[model samples]
Target: METFFSNQKQTLSRAFCLSAAVICLGATNNAWALFSDDEARKAILDLRKSLATTQLELQGEIDKLKADNAELRGKIEGLEKQGEDISSSQKTYYQDLDTRLGNFEPRTATIEGVSGTVQPNEKKAYDDALKAFQAGNLKKADEAFSAFANKYPKSPYLPLALYWGGNSKYANKDYAGSISQLQSLIKRYPNHPRIPAAMVTLGSSQLESGNKIAAKKTFNEIIAKYPDTDAAKDAHQLIAATK
Candidate 1:
């Protein structure tokens, strides 16, 4: 009976130790699971923070690039405008230079049914003389016309200058000078458009110089050659007055 009791006690003690070991193992497994869950949560939070930081960096870079691109575009536009202004200025400068050059160059022009190449200085001289004559400065006109005739002897303006010079001389009451110029014109350019008018002046100059015989001869010649001209009528009147 005593030995049976002793075996029973030993079996009870073994069961108690096994129960304690199972309890300890279960507690250790639960603690490990809790630690693993905390570590996984921390890793997820860290990953999320890193992603947010990376996103912020990328956005900052994008903004900087955009600003840079805008600045570059503005610079390009400014350069283009500067280039256009430079081009315009160059064009204006060249045009002004060309106009200045044109003044010194010879050009084709027509004056009193005479077309030819005329130098700028030559045209200005002729125009100034003609302007003086038209302004009724008789002495200046005579001098200018005489100078022009002597200076540009081969000029197409010679005939007109001589004609005006003769008239100016006559207006100045220089009858001898008038006679000389008119006679020269009549002899040199007999078929000139101013011949009839010049001959009338010649006849009047002769009469004024107390040469009635020559004046009468000139009047008859005018009536014979240019009978329908106004100068011929003037000559007829002068002849009647002399009579």
Candidate 2:
């Protein structure tokens, strides 16, 4: 009977050991699965951080490019303005030279079935009147220019004579006479080189006479008809001021 009891105890011990080994194996497998999940979570977080950093770097580069674009635009605008100023100066110088040379050059014109020769004395008279006008002697300049216009209607200097006469009238505050003379200039000398100046003078006279509507019309005509001209540029500034 004692031997039977010892054999039963030994068998129970072996069963206990087998059950403990199974429990340890199962616990080891569960711990491995938990470790794998933690590693996967860490890798996912690191990938998200890298993507965010790349996006921030791309945005910084875009901002720098925008600033560079703005600077280039400003430089281009400045260059265009400088070019315009130089062109305007050159145009004025050439125009003055052309006006001076026109005195010595005798031009042919037909008037009333007769062609008359322009005299050197006529050039002198016109030049003297112009000098007086440039020196701001409006009264004498007007008298001289009027005499020239009346005496030499068929002269090649007629268009310039009429234009200068109108300017003198404007300087003397004779707005009506200025308008009449400038209107005659436009009608007679539509293709004259000094027509733009005449138009600007006419517009100025209109403005001086409290004819705001007429002035606006004249300025608008310049911008519409001769937008690339210096006269048109000045008219635009004056109109903007009025507005």
Candidate 3:
């Protein structure tokens, strides 16, 4: 019986020791599992931080690209405006140059039933004399026309100038000068359009200068040459009155 009790005690002690060892191993396993869980959580947090930092860098790059694009667009707009201004200025310059160049060019003109190419200077000189006549400055007109006739002896305006100069002299009561101009015009341009008027002026000038005989002969010549015309009628009246 004592030996049996001893064996029972030994078995109980062995069982107790095995139970304690199993408890220790279970505690150590629990600690190891907790440590593993903490490490996994820390790793997740580090990954989240890395993602946030990368997102921030991407956003910064996007903003910088947008800013650069806007600046480039503004520069392009400014360059376009400058190019337009340069084009406009060039057009204006060319237009001004063309206008200035047109002044010295010869042009076609029709003067006193004569179509011809007239130089700018020649046309201006003739127009100036005509302007003087139209302004009623008869003396200046006469001088200008006479100078033109002397300067441009072969000008087509010669016949008209002679006629106007003679009339200008008559208006100034320069009867001898008028007669001289009229006679020269008649001798030079016998078939001129001012012939009838020149004949009348000559006859009137002769009558005023106390040469009724010459006036009568001129009036008879007009009646014979230009019959049934107004000048002929005027000549008839003058001849009857003078006789």
Candidate 4:
């Protein structure tokens, strides 16, 4: 059989072993809890970093899109303005063309203190005849004026045309033709403003044609009809020369 002291010593050794086992288990559990907390904090930090980076990327993309959109809008506006300007320029160009074309159409006009309806080519005809006459193209002027008289019988330029044609004949030294034209004009337009000038031309043409008696008669008639006028002055000088 065992002694009592030996039994007591064994009981104390068993209690101490049990207490050491409990303390070791408690320390292991505390160490495991601290490790889990540290892992959770590290995971949270990594997740926050990922979120921040994603947000920055998203914001950068949005900013780029906004910039691209603004540039596209500006280009669109510029194209629209350019289109409008082209349209306006085309309109202006057409309007100018229309105005320029309208100039060629016939319209009523006053010529040589005479108001009358002129044809499309009437003014040009008269101007061409007058230009020919002024340029000393006497035959051309006569033919042109004669054609004008025959073409436009009731033209307001009739009296003037006949008058210039007679002058053209005179300048061409066609004394008989000049006298015929001047006499016809006198008989046709008795109250014409060009009568005195016509008489002067007729008398001068008669004198140049060696018809002194006819020339003297014409000058006397002019002096009787238009006294103190330029025609009368010319006639007085002629009559004195003839005498």
Candidate 5:
């Protein structure tokens, strides 16, 4: 009976020790699980923060690139506009230079049924002299026509100039000058359209110079050569008056 009780006591003690060791192991496992959960949560938070910072940096870089691109586009447009303006200015400058050069070059022109190459200065001179004559300045007309005739003897305007010069001299009562000019025109341009009128002037100039015989002879020649002309009618009347 004593031995049975001792065995029972020993078994009870072993059971108590085993139960305490199981409780201690359970507590250590729960603590390890809590620590592992906290470490995982901290790692997740750190990863999220790093991702957010990287996104912000990337966005800043993108915005800077956009602004740089816009600035580059603006500079390119400004350069293009400047190039266009310079090209336009150069074209206008060249056109103006060409026009200035054209004035010095000779050009073809037609004047009074005569077509030829005429110098710019030559045309201007003729125009100025003709303008003076048409303004009814008789002395200026005479001088200008005479100068033109002497200066440009080979000009197509010579016959007209001589005719107008003779008429101007006659109007100024320059009888000797009129006779000389008209005779020159008649001798030089016998088939000219102004011949009949020139001969009539010649007849009148001869009469004014007291050469009636020469005047009568000129009137008869006009009636024989250009009987249908107005100058011939005037010549006939003048001859009747003289007779």
Candidate 6:
């Protein structure tokens, strides 16, 4: 009976020991699961921090780009304004030059007792032609004007002298000679202010010379080239009369 009681107590003690081991294993497993959850949470927080840093860096780059763009735009606007100002200044300068060139006039000769400060020959020749014209010596006027033109081919008055010589020829009943001389004047003085006058004379001479087509052409040319001049107005009247 004593041996049986000792065996029973040993069985009970083994059962209790087995129960304590099972409880200890269950607690260790739960603690290990809790530690794993904490590590996963830490990793998630680090990932969120990394994402925030990347986003901030991207925003900084965007801000820098905007500032650079603004600076470049300002510079471009300044250059455009400068270019416009330069263009306006250049236009004004050219306009002033054109005005000055258009208003220039030749100085007159025949100063004091002397013929002229420059070009004494021109003064003498011109004075001789005028005197003959005033005296009503048409033939002598023609001779003086012809001599002036021939001797002073480079003179500014050469065009006027030729023109008056043609008029003198017409007055002397030399219509064919007048036509020839006036045509020569028109050819010689293309840009002269007296060109319209020469054209009118040439047209009249051409009409007298029986060159009706040439007369019409000269009248039309004067009206087209010198629309604002009195000679053009006269040419138009004569053209209407002829037609």
Candidate of highest lDDT = 4
Q: What root-mean-square deviation over C-alphas does model 1 reach?
A: 11.5
- Candidate 5 global CA lDDT score: 0.85
**Pairing residues by index, what is the TM-score of model 2?**
0.52
Per-model C-alpha RMSD? 11.5, 16.7, 12.0, 12.2, 12.4, 12.3
TM agreement with the true structure for every prediction: 0.54, 0.52, 0.52, 0.54, 0.53, 0.49
lDDT of 3 by residue, 1-243 (tens): 999999999999999999999999999999999999999999999999999999999999999999999999999999999999999999999989865654577656556664556554665677788899889999998898888778766666777777788877777788788789989988987877677778887788888777889899989888888886787888888876566
Per residue, candidate 4 scores C-alpha lDDT tens digits across 70-133 of 9999999999999999999999999998656545654565555555666667767888999999
Relative to the true structure, how large is the alpha-carbon lDDT of every model? 0.87, 0.86, 0.83, 0.88, 0.85, 0.80
**TM-score: the better of candidates 4 and 6:** 4
Clashing pairs in 6: none
Candidate 1: worst 10 consecutive residues by lDDT?
111-120
Q: Give per-residue CA lDDT, model 2, range 1-243, as digits (tens).
A: 999999999999999999999999999999999999999999999999999999999999999999999999999999999999999999999999866666676655543333556754787888989999999999999999999999888787778888999999999999999999999988887877778888888988988888878888888988898899998998987776345
lDDT minimum window of 10 residues, candidate 3: 111-120
lDDT of 2: 0.86
As a whole number from 0 to 100, the lDDT of residue 84 in candidate 2 is 99
- Per residue, candidate 6 scores C-alpha lDDT tens digits across 96-180 of 9755554453334433221322244465677789689778899999999988877777666677777788888887868888888
**Model 4 root mean square deviation, Cα atoms:** 12.2
Distance from true location, Cα of 218 in model 3, Å:
1.7
Q: Write the per-residue lDDT of candidate 1 for residues 1-243, one digit (tens) a residue.
A: 999999999999999999999999999999999999999999999999999999999999999999999999999999999999999999999999866765798766655665566664665677788888899998998999899888877666777888889988988989999999988888877888889999998898888889899999999999999999998899989997555
Clash pairs (backbone) in predicted model 2:
none
